[model samples]
Target: MKNLPLGMNTLAKLIKQNCVYVDKTQMAWQLICQPGAFFLSRPRRFGKSLFVDTLKEIFEGNKPLFKGLYIHDKWDWTQSYPVIKIDFSDGTLQTRESLDRRIYEILFDNATRLNVTLSKGRDIPGTFGELIRFSAEKYGTRAVVLVDEYDKPILDNIENRDTAKIMREGVKNLYSVLKGQDAYLQFIFMTGVTKFSKVSLFSGVNQLTDITIDAQFGTLCGYTHHDLQTHFSKHLDGIEQEEIKQWYNGYYWLGETTVYNPYDILLFINKRAQFRNYWFETGNPSFLIKLFQKNRYFLPDLESPVVTEEILDSFDIEKINPLTLLFQSGYLTVAHTFTRRRRMMFLLKVPNLEVRIALNDHFINGYTDLVNEKIGIQDNLYTCLENGDIDGMLKVIQRLFKSIPWRNFTNNDLADFEGYYASVIYAFFCSLDAEVIPEDIDNHGQVDMTVKLGDQIYVMEIKVVDGTNADKLNCNPALKQIQDKGYADKYRGIDGVTVHEVGLVFSKASRNLIVF
Candidate 1:
């Protein structure tokens, strides 16, 4: 196996140094066939820059890299076009002036590559235009423009709307220069993480074809399963294929297309060990946590589909929206898309188990309930499971519920609060290595939670009621709902299994847990 391209983004260097290449050659071939301007949005470090650099090499007519690749026989390598590669990932741009200075510098650097020096102290837009004209005049061919991480400046300050808007305006001004200069440009391709509305970045450049959701180029930025199996066969010879898939291979782009995280996969193969959160550790997303807190999101729903384009696309950041943040940050991806009554929608969920565990820890920290808890609670729960103590488990759960901060619970309605509490308890037991099944009791018609402990199973049904109405829940009619629904029916046949039906109610006025 070749050395991993951990921090390397330049395609020429990667090819020259003989690092492991996942062969996106077919994608390159298809991209070249498409006409006009293009834009692609993918998560960070998913080979976006590398794809841009590959285009830079291809347009510059670097024939050597294509000798054994897919475009070897098809592309006409004789025509070389001047390529302007603008990468905005150098440093975080906080101010408008700083961004302008950085843009000027990048344009000047590209000018020097073409052997054309700016006279002196020229404005960024003017310098950029001059570079295009210079390339066309000198090379006698139109220029190929590739802009990478085009939204980095705005993304750096996404939490601060004002700052992000300022940076967005600056980028819009700079990009607007390319609109009318079609004569000097042969093709333009820009890559970023998020697809802001055209009014946000492109402004009037609506000619930019967004290929982010295009099926043809969906596999352009990441390694497909076939690419990994065929190209990196040596690296997979001794490793557990299932483990690798669990950790890095869950992102779905086009329908039925499964892709791997090139960054984590490469790093793991090079280091030869199963490490946790390799890509996430590259940068801490503190802002996402703040979003979660502001929105008061229920964390346990990470496993279920949180589908809504409006929430996913334009969710307000002032309030912490965990689902949107997770989707935008690549921890979760678009599982599938469907059209209903002329409306298109996407279904989002946790990509895989790796993300599931990582997100669980993230939520645990977001809420204060996980920390400063009695160690005895976990110990008692584990012991109950070991001894098949159904009654002991229920007691442990009731005790745990009583420890919650009452003031916070009173704000939400009783029934909703009960559901939230039950979900959290389900997650807690799950984290402790206990087998807890959710929505499994058919007897009560609505079973909140169920736990399987060796030969013993505890079937639980939870309900929340106000302090004044709490007595109504203890009546036999309410308890009979659990039996009629057959919530405990499925577990009856298991050997040595004990099923305990439990009903929990909470007071909306006082935020107190009432166990029956």
Candidate 2:
């Protein structure tokens, strides 16, 4: 296999080093050939930086890089524009002062590159405006502005509203110059992980056409299936094609075909075709877990979050929604879209196994009990489920609840509701990477959960008592529901499968488990 572009983002270096270049020049050509400014939002490590660099190279008249590429003759190499590249992901920007200094330095560097002397009396916004005009005048060509990770400064301080707001204003001031200096700008493109609509950066430069959800540019940053087979065919020796596709592919943007996480694919091939959680290991995403916990989001509801276009686009930080955060942050993706009463609806789901499995671990850590007790509970839980020890599994659940801090249960009557117990049990099953149909509705009614083991299928019925009244809370009723309702009937005659019915009841006051 050719030298994989490992941790490579610069377009010039990637080309000069003779790395396998997936020709995305066609998409680059389409973007620049059009008019006005544009913004693209993709997940981190999705080649946003490389795409920005590619645009910079195209405008800088790097014709040799596109020699055998798709847009070799299609691009106009005679006219090269001075490019002003701004990257906010270089250093951490916690305070507004740091943000201001960083912008000043970036403008200074750009001026030095264009061989243009900037005035000492101007602020950042004024300096940026001067750079655009001066660079255009010096090079005799309109300057092309390319910004990578434009929202990093704001995103870094997102948890703190005060700090984030300060950083937001600083970045906004810098971007505001773009609107008035349009005459000196050829084309402007900005890429970031998040789109902050409330920030003045977007409001000031309102002409920026957001192509984030636009289906036309879905394959702009990431590799398509065709891209893999055509470009990286040499590295596909022992890899199972379908398995690879299942693990790394299926990131949809409402396009005809799905987009694969190029980072995962590259690492998978580089590591001798090993299937691993390459993308998930890079970022833990504690923010998402915190958001879900704060919002009291139903874990099972994440399976298929139905949302509208407005929900997908406008992500207001003040009133943050789990679905919006999940979708934008790459945990969830547009699985399918349909029209209902003339309004479009989108169904979002976890992209692949790497995300589903990894997110489960993170969710368990944040949602349920974590660490010390979690390790033992989960270990026994998995072992018991595999061995078809329903009693052992129940003990694990009892242990899980007991391990939680007393303060957690002070106000929250978690044991009072069947949904609460079912959700916790569901989370545990999912965390162990088991197949569980949570809230499985059968002919007998709604079963709490149905878990599939090697040769055993377990149908679980969970009941909760309001008080210590055994007369009102009978385990026989719960047991009858599982059998009379025929919850496990479907799996009874399946080949090489054994069906087991588990009826469980828990008391709200005592928090004791009773299995029938």
Candidate 3:
């Protein structure tokens, strides 16, 4: 059995070290056949660097490394080209001046590799251009350029718009050099997490093609189901496949097949247990949290569809923009896209279950309202559900309404209470591994919450009372509303699943609940 390639990205090194390699040979072959200035955008740690390194070995005329591989006999070993690879992940540049120095250092390093000497006193961009031209001239071949994490600097300062803009400008100055040197470049490939159209490098050099949504290259960056089944079959066979699928296989791109984040999948298998979110642990998402806060967007809405183009693009970091930042950062992808009555629209949701839970925890910590507080209410709703005390549940709801922050709940602002209550209930039951669903009977309008506890099923109806009449509560029209909605109609045929219905009402005056 081959070991997992945890952080290895070099194809030759992985082969020599006897690490597991899921062959993306077909994709590689397709790329080589139609090579040009290409840009691919994918989430972080999805093997972009490995793909770039593979391209380097192939184009640098390393035929020996291709032995027993897909392109072994098809590729020509006699043709070798100079390669200039840039990895913008060293955290070397913090300011514009430092950025300029780093760019010069990168150029010097590449020039030395090609045995080309640079004279003193040359501008950074000018020296970089000279190095490419010199390498091509000396080697009698065009140089292949590969850039990884091309947007790292901008992402690092996303929280500070001013700093992010400055970094963008400095990086743009370095990338603009590529535009005029196309004649001396054989092929140029750049990979980054987000697509920033305002970057002068992309705008000035209109020759490069973005293959992010192209179906042919959709699986180019991440691992596909086929890759997992073929390469990691044994490791998966040892674990619960259903649990793995539920956690990692929800992301869909271009309406094509779902893919697993290669980094997360490998880490999960190596660790031999379902652990806390490893992907989120790689970097801080404080910028994203700030975006959510500024936008006044409900964090729970992340599980549902968040649709808007302005939120998806041209987001000003100075303000909170959940849709734009999430999409740009790769946490949410284009689930579906179309023009609705002349405007382009997209459906945005959490990419996978791992991300969903990580995001939930992130919001839970950031928002004080999400946590439970001991105040004017005496009963605990979570404890009632755990102990199967249905009456206790009703009393708890009554106390909750009494403690309602009227200022926060007025002016129809509490419209999201249904969703909020549902989320809290769901979280509570999920903590106990109980199957729970909110608004499960949408057609009947009968049930507010449904929980499968042991062998019994509980059906609940919740209503907000506007008047103060404990005796007239059952006589109220809301009592009949649940029966009219037929919330329990679907459970008629399931044997051994006893269903119990409970109605609980709340008062808007005293903000207290009455249960029968």
Candidate 4:
């Protein structure tokens, strides 16, 4: 078996080292068949950089690297175009000056490689336009431009809105030059994590085609099921295939095929097939979590969010939508789609078990004060649910809520809002790997929360009341509401599974569970 291409992004190195390569040259060929600007957006570590490098090797006419590849026979080896490359995956640039320096270094390196001298005393845009024109003039053919991680500079400083905006304009100024060099450029393809409106980042080059959601290229970067069964079959011997798919294979791009992140697959095999949060552990999303909490977003909404096409397509630094950020950052993915009022709508969900567990784990931390104790609580909760121990589960939940820091409610009205408690509970259930549904609908009305665990199911309702009346209940109002509304009736007859109706009440004065 060929060696796995762990952390390898360059196409030439992978081929030369005899690493397992899923053939993407067919997609590359299709992309270059026409000469125009193209843009693709994908979450980080999803093989965007590798695809960009593949395009570089192809455009440079390195036919020796294409041995046994699909594009080798189809592409013309006699003609090679000048290629200018820009990659921002190396280091973080915090300010405009640093970003400018990095841009110059990238342009200069490309000019040196292409043997084109940039005009001295020229600004970035002027120098870029000059390099494109000169490189095409010298090579006697139009040039191909490939940019990897095109939005990284702006994203690096996203915490500081002013700096982020400045970095945005700086990169925008550089990309603006591409518009005037249309006659000199043969093809332009840029890859990034997020998609900004053309007016925000690519107004000058507004003609660029965005293929991020194009069905034809959906499987271009990630590993498909066929790839796992074929290219890396040797490495997957004795491993539970369904388990692997459950952990890592659910990302879709409006295509028939769902794919596994190459990073996760490579790391999974390298670590001897131990199922872990391989991809999620690579980056910290503290900013995203903070943003979600700042917005007071209901954690259960992430179970399945319905969004319009406009919500997913437009991203700007000035107003960052938490949903868009989550989707673009790979924490959420498209699960289903439908037409509502003649408009295309998407049903977004956590792609797989890896994301569902790991993301909610983070949300648990963000929503509560018990950081170190979360794992213990989640473990106990899991056992309680699996064994159908409602009393044990209630004790664990009360313990979980009792640990919340008072500061979480001091400056905020969280104590008065039932959603605050419900969201926290929802996040805990999600972290336990329970099949949780928020606002679950029934024939009568909507259930506040529904959880399916092993052979047990729970239909729950939450209510907030003042501490003065906390002791006056003959029946837990939450449970009474569930029984009154017939929320559990829908799941009562399922074979081999027991349906449970649970009601929980919180006291505003104590800011904790009062009745369970």
- lDDT leader: 4
lDDT of 3 by residue, 317-393 (tens): 34535666676666787777778778877787667667765655555333324335432222265566656677776
Residues 1-516, model 4: lDDT tens digits: 999999999998998899998989999999998898899989999999889999999888899998888998999988899999999999999988999999999999999999999888889999999989999999999999999999999988888889999999999989999988899999999999999887799898848998887789988889999999999998998899999999999998787899999999999999999899999999798889888777888788888899997788788888899999888888888887899999989899899999988888888888886789998998999999999999999999889888888887767777788888888898888877889989999889998999999999999999998874666977798988888899999898889999888899998888788898
For model 4, what is the C-alpha lDDT against the true structure?
0.90
- Our tally of clashes for model 1 stands at 11
List the candidate numbers ranked by lDDT, top first.
4, 2, 1, 3
Candidate number of the best TM-score: 4
Those runs of model 1 whose alpha carbons end farther than 4 Å from true positions after fitting are 119-123, 306-322, 369-416, 419-423, 426-502, 506-516
Candidates in order have lDDT scores of: 0.72, 0.81, 0.69, 0.90
TM-score of 2: 0.91
Number of the candidate with higher lDDT, 1 or 4: 4
Assess candidate 3 and give its TM-score to the true structure.
0.78
TM-score of 4: 0.98
Residue runs of model 2 more than 4 Å from their true location after superposition: 198-201, 372-376, 407-420, 441-448, 466-472, 476-497, 510-516
User: How many times do residue backbones clash in model 3?
Assistant: 4
Q: Estimate each model's TM-score.
A: 0.83, 0.91, 0.78, 0.98
